[model samples]
Target: MSSSAHSDVAPIVVSDVVKRFDKVTALDHVSLSVLRGETFGLIGPNGSGKTTLIRMLLGLGRPTSGNISVLGRKMPSRQVASRIGYMTQSSALYNELSIRENLAFFGTLYGLRGRRLKERIAATLSLVELAARADSPIQTLSGGMRQRVSLGCALIHEPELIFLDEPTVGIDPELRLAFWEYFAQLNQRGVTLVVSTHHLDEAARCNRLGLLRFGRLLAADSPDALRARSGQQDFEQAFLYFAQQAETAEAGEPTPAAEKEA
Candidate 1:
């Protein structure tokens, strides 16, 4: 396809993807698409395969079956690596290096250099509100500060798509709110974000959410739509309703709502 045509495609497309570890299935025929410039949330409890899916999307792992395309290119493509950012759950910064140094290091890895690299470091620091402590060593910073640095490093390259794995975990409510504000600004600037979180309340913030359970995607839609479909105003209750429906269908039993409709 032409480059412009490729650009018109969805940022992420996963078709019937399955991931396995020996006999254990990490992802089971899960499929979803994330549109350009949208905030897509993967909502599920731990071990629901959110991290596994994110790893595949980042090209760090491969699905045992099916396919995934990221940024109009097949996953594990080096060509798309530089155009994406990933903020892992754990800190990936160097303990001995200063925040500024760490940003420069990650920026260089993304093929940035010279004046441009320096400019990005400054801009990233400002964006994360860590300019005042740019020279502080990673080990000297608190957990919250370290998380901010991690975010800065991920954004240093100004990628078109970003994957955040529980980015707000372990942070204070105020800091979590600040992080969401930053995310909103990124979305306004046309950056696509794929965030995985177990916090049900966070699901409402995304443009769309995929409810995952046991490595399967139960439903993909907007928060209001999911709630309306399940007839539950509470997001958590709606998720439970979908889970029950999936179980009913799997057991060859008509769901309560289906029986009602019939």
Candidate 2:
């Protein structure tokens, strides 16, 4: 669970990022940085803007304000797109295509071809435990199996940074554990990961976590650090403690700490 040392430049950096849909603010001055070779979790309930922020980082959506840079290049940089991989919350697989064919398509899109593409596709399939189903049609697979295919597609190019949005959704607990182990292997090999998930226990497995509520960040730190700061025994309790503090502050009331010392 040790992360590789980071360089001067972070893999993903967000500064005062804001996204608004008319009057609804999806992100409000959101800011954080993800280091290389670490798994950073975005933990929040639904509608907390995790997906919106991830879209901006991937250059799929522009922030209404502020900045985001990935891999030392300004975002939406097509030149560096090949070095980044994204697994969206929804399955993006082609229902009519076989797993191998889907891999081939995505690989070609990432400029992989010929022998190299074949080798990469094979490796990715094995990595996700989908090698046995390589030729199976996407429509024939179960929800979890399909998710694995989507993951394999993203890793086909061996990207340096990956963004996984709720990757463990619909996956069984045992399979989810296996996926986390695979993520550790990727991190050990110098791949950075930005994972958005609502599972608090999985969030605790990350090297660092950003806890979000109502489109605002309540805290950003190691899970253990957050637990210590909030004097809580678990990640969920720590989150609730911070969230309550945020609510009280917004109401101009004394925080829990001030109330404790008073």
- Give the top-scoring candidate (TM-score): 1
| lDDT digits (tens) for residues 1-262 of candidate 2 | 1123236688888887789999999988777888889999999999999999898899888889988888877776676788889998987999999999999999999999899999998899989888888999999999998988999888999988999999998899988998899899999999999999999999889999998888888888888888999999888899899899878877785531211100
Worst 10 residues of 1 by lDDT: 253-262
Encode model 1's per-residue lDDT on 1-262: one tens digit a residue: 2265245789899988889999999988888899888899999999999999999999998899999999888887777888899999897899999999999999999999999999999999999999999999999999999999999988999998999999989988888888889999999999999999988988899999998888888899988888999999999999999899888877885532221100
35: Cα error in model 1, Å: 0.4
Alpha carbon lDDT of each predicted model: 0.89, 0.87
Cα deviation of 205, candidate 1, in Å = 0.6
Q: What is the TM-score of each candidate against the true structure?
A: 0.94, 0.93
Clashing pairs in 2: none
